[model samples]
Target: MNATEKFYLPVDGIFDMFTSLTSPSAVTHPVVQSAVAPQQHPKAPSFSKTGMGIIRMVKESWRQPMAHRSSSSSTGRQLSIERQAKRSVDLLELGLAKPKNCHRIVVLGAARVGKTNILQRFLGNDFDESYAPTAEDFHRKLFHIGGDAYQVDLLDAASERNFPAKRRLSILTGDTFLLVFSLDDRESLHHVRDMLDEIAAAKAKLLKLKHPAKVPAVICGNKADLTSPGAVTRSEVTQALGKDVTYFETSAKDGTGLEGAFRALAALGGLPDETSPSRHQLISLLSYQTLCISQRGRGGLRARGHGAPCAAMDPLARRPSFTSDLRLLLKSGSNKNNKPEMCHVQ
Candidate 1:
């Protein structure tokens, strides 16, 4: 037989079985044939009961893929709904209040100078023992004080310091600065001195002052916990950094002198008193909202539960992208007396 005949042989057999099952003389006749059957040739193979099993198997195979497709569509829809729900929950917890003012604080230092650890301390996080070089780290803290929302964005400028243009941009955009150096490394102190010079130049160019006044900044000598006899002395650091800048000796490991330094930073930036870490209570977003509502019913920010103000934080906060940072710089420059000239940075 040809290929075509061979292919049609099983189909012909199936039809024969179906015809016989629906024949008028067949024993079972409770059902009626809905359509007329094709003419059956005498040479066709006789109907076999086994052919019904083949027909049922073919039908089942055809149905499986459609069933599977339906199931996959349902699973995809469910996952989409779940993702949307999670985003809603995050928005609810992170707060929807617009900030009255934001202070952009930048931390500049050489790599492994414990800059990250100091920032962690400010954010109420424990010291991390592991050391990893940072590209750029950003953190945000929200303060609800005096019936106003204030935001502080802290940027850790680690490896970015090597790129002069990016570093200059940070200095220009930064409202407050923290320059950190390790006592164990004298070269790091020199790096800090160079950064200070750059900061002065950048500020002078932007503010157009006859002489660059002392910018709102704090110089931190980190790693005081180390007992290295060869470390730089506090007096030498003071002389190198000059007596004008506010300086502090901090121990990231021991968690000493960090809070005082932060308070000093806030004060220099002209921030609210409650912006100091010790001056406010850190509360969850839900409780913060509850207190704010109750305070509104009683009086304004100073009433009852709102006396200390409430601070809320976002653990998943990240640094703005490069483009966003540039936009922020330009926006801030526009608000000042002079707009900084934009230049190409390679």
Candidate 2:
């Protein structure tokens, strides 16, 4: 059959199927009873009785036209089918599964202050060789710090001088903020006040809403590896940030002080303690077994041979770079081109 004929054939079948589904007796019975009733004209009432009687008459008169115009069985069935189809599509799109508990953390700092690099070291566990500036918002793998899973959203702008107003608003929407400052650069440290002000403004706006106590803030001092003696004093940062704010000295290059900073932020977010026996801890323990086998064989047996020395059987022996192993676990796919991008002030 032609395309038009083919389309009409199913439509005709559907119409016949609907006709079969409906009982013809229902329609004919009503019409036959109406025809059999004698045609009589009623006279109008001359006077109203009580107020209730008049109101009752008016209500019945209004309901008659509405009842006549309302849908029969066939129309109701079609409408129900359409509604069910729409609901099915909605449920499928939403997966009908409860959303996982996710914490949103935002990393904020002046341009080239190692904000993205800190995020990468925490999220990807790999440091980038060359620095490529962040144009817009960037996201990395979700990390399980303490016992809760957090999705970190890193917002590293191109320049401190040109921080977008809207971007600041977006970052403020996060559950927690990680304000980073470069220890090597004095200018980046000076701009910390402006960054904190922007964060406070966002928090103030959020407090005006129904729930006020959800937001938290953290102050992180990056490039701790560069902190020797006279370079950038820890006392200077402590004096600048004050005692109320949480402070951390982190080095993305040497992986110094990174873990403590993340743990502090996670603690401030009210994430469950790592010691808690949770599903995340179970999964992490299982994943670690894979590493144990690759590094130290069964029962501390060295991969080299069974007769090898015990100290030589250390996992660090086989795996020279523990960070690379971590990167493999955290990264979704082994994309060689995937290198961590550094954010550092000139």
Candidate 3:
């Protein structure tokens, strides 16, 4: 054995070799100092006493964003849903700050019939001539009629091609219906009858309102400027429909009857009663017809020799009616009977 190794005490074997991982100063013990390497000692603070500080440093690192810390709690680690909820609340507050008088008007008709054009004209927006099939569109406008303000929500819905259960809600919820058809297109006018029937059927099956015409629906004849001479006369519409229905003539190109149609619709809603007439209890559709027919024939429509009496005179089919702001603006034409047309009744 070497000379240094020969100097061993029996008591040295009492305890096994001792070193420290927690502190550098533990090497001050001569036994530990002799056994440990001096270069291997870390110069920083001892990790045992500084462990909390190291944990705090790790927490601070996570507090700041990876890119760059901007503000107190606006780091990327924030919950995304919490931020979205806050934004939604702010928007709701802004929306509720001021009251809005919103009216939903449904524009329904066949394609290429200017249903979109009338809405755009009312909105003062640009018109697109592209033939894109509409599957329910929405537009908004703020207008004033007779010193009162209103926000009209125009639902430019697709045609009957897509009127499944999902889309029929538009028909049920509309505040007013603008059934648009081109004045130049007589087939569109004929198609309107089918639409009305569909609406009536839908209402009958869905809503049990006092009036069948619960929604203030009006048939709008678009493309007035495109009509030839004597094309879409009020007489023609009345005869085709066989009964009076709310109607309007509009030209989206030159903007004719647009404002009036909207104004009339507002009146029809009976909100701004300033434009609508006073409460006129619905007298009778038959009464209006009898009034017209009796003026021509004396004594409750005099029997014209075994011919069936007028439909108005027949009490079986002739039923109840209600008063509305609905009125027909006839252009003064004679019917097949060579008599003056029926008077405009509201």
The top-ranked prediction according to TM-score is 1
Model 2 lDDT, residue 294, Cα: 35
Give the 10-residue window scoring lowest on summed lDDT in candidate 3.
319-328
Better candidate number, 1 or 3, judged by TM-score:
1
Model 1 residue 242 CA deviation in Å:
0.9
Against the true structure, candidate 1 reaches a TM-score of 0.65
Q: Candidate 2, residues 1-346: lDDT per residue as tens digits?
A: 2345433323334333334323334323343335323533232122212333555566578668975675688567556545433321111122221123334566667777787777766544477767878643444223233222233334443343454654544444456778888888766776775666666665554344443333377777777777455455668876776666777777878877777777776676665434122222223322332333333334331232322111101111121123442343334222358753221111
Which parts of model 2 are misplaced by more than 4 Å? 1-100, 143-154, 157-163, 209-215, 227-230, 273-346
Error of 2 at 87 (Å): 22
lDDT by residue (1-346, candidate 3, tens digit) is: 2447644423222122221335434545565445454546464336434654555565567567665746656554244433433321211122311233445677778778988777666554556767666643765433233223334456665653454643455555556778888787788888777777666655554443455544467778887777498468888888876556777787877777776676677666654532221211222333333233343344332222322211111112211111111111122223557664443221
Clashes of each: 0, 0, 1
TM-score of each: 0.65, 0.46, 0.47
Q: Give the TM-score of candidate 2.
A: 0.46
Candidate 1, run of 10 with poorest lDDT:
27-36
lDDT of each candidate versus the true structure: 0.71, 0.49, 0.52
